[model samples]
Target: MKSKLKMKDEILEYTHKEIENIKESFCKEYEHKIQAVIEEKDKEIHAMQKKFKDLNEENTENKNEIAKLGKMLEDANKKIKKRDMEMYILLDENKKQKEKAAKKMNKVNELLNNLQKEYTDNIP
Candidate 1:
């Protein structure tokens, strides 16, 4: 009876040790899996941060381009105004020239009429 009780105690002790070892190993594996998951999440977060930075840079470049285009548009408008002023000056000068030509034509017509009257009187 004593030997049988000793054998039973030894078996129970061995089983308890094995259970403790399995628990420890499972806990270590679980910790390792959690660490892997955490590392993967960190990598994803880093990638997202890099993408955000790139997008911000692109946005800044676009803003700069828009500003440059705006400046160019303003310059073009100024040039157009200058061209319009030049065109108006040319038109004004042309109008003055036409007026002068009409005055000269009127004087020539008057001189021709006087010449015609003198010739007609002399013939009779």
Candidate 2:
């Protein structure tokens, strides 16, 4: 009876120690998995932040390019306006010269007619 009791006590103690070791191992594995998940999330957050920064830089560059194009367009429009003004001035000057030439031609024709009449009277 004593031997039987001792054997039963020894078996119970071994079972308790095995259970404690299994619990410790499960806790360690759970902590390891949680840590790994946290690290992965941190990496994802960093990647998203970098992408956002890159997009902001691209947006800034686009805005600058648009402003530059707008300025160039304004300058070109000014040049066109100046060229149009010059063309109008030249056309007006040409019109005035034509009017002066027409007046001179009329005066010359009248003088020629008068001279012909005088020559005809003298011959008779």
- Go through the candidates in order and give the clash count of each: 0, 0
State each model's CA lDDT, in order.
0.96, 0.94
RMSD of candidate 2 to true structure, Å? 3.5
Model 1, C-alpha of 77: deviation from truth (Å) = 0.7
Over 3-98, each residue of candidate 2 has an lDDT whose tens digit, in order, gives 999999998999999999999999999989999999999999999999999999999999999999999999999999999999999999999999
List clashing residue pairs in candidate 1: none
Q: Give lDDT: candidate 1, residue 27.
A: 96
Name the lDDT of candidate 1: 0.96
lDDT of 2 at 86: 97
| Model 1, residue 112: C-alpha shift (Å) | 2.8
- In model 2, what lDDT does residue 100 have? 96
Residue 35 Cα positional deviation in candidate 1, in Å, after optimal superposition:
2.0
> What lDDT, from 0 to 1, does candidate 2 have?
0.94
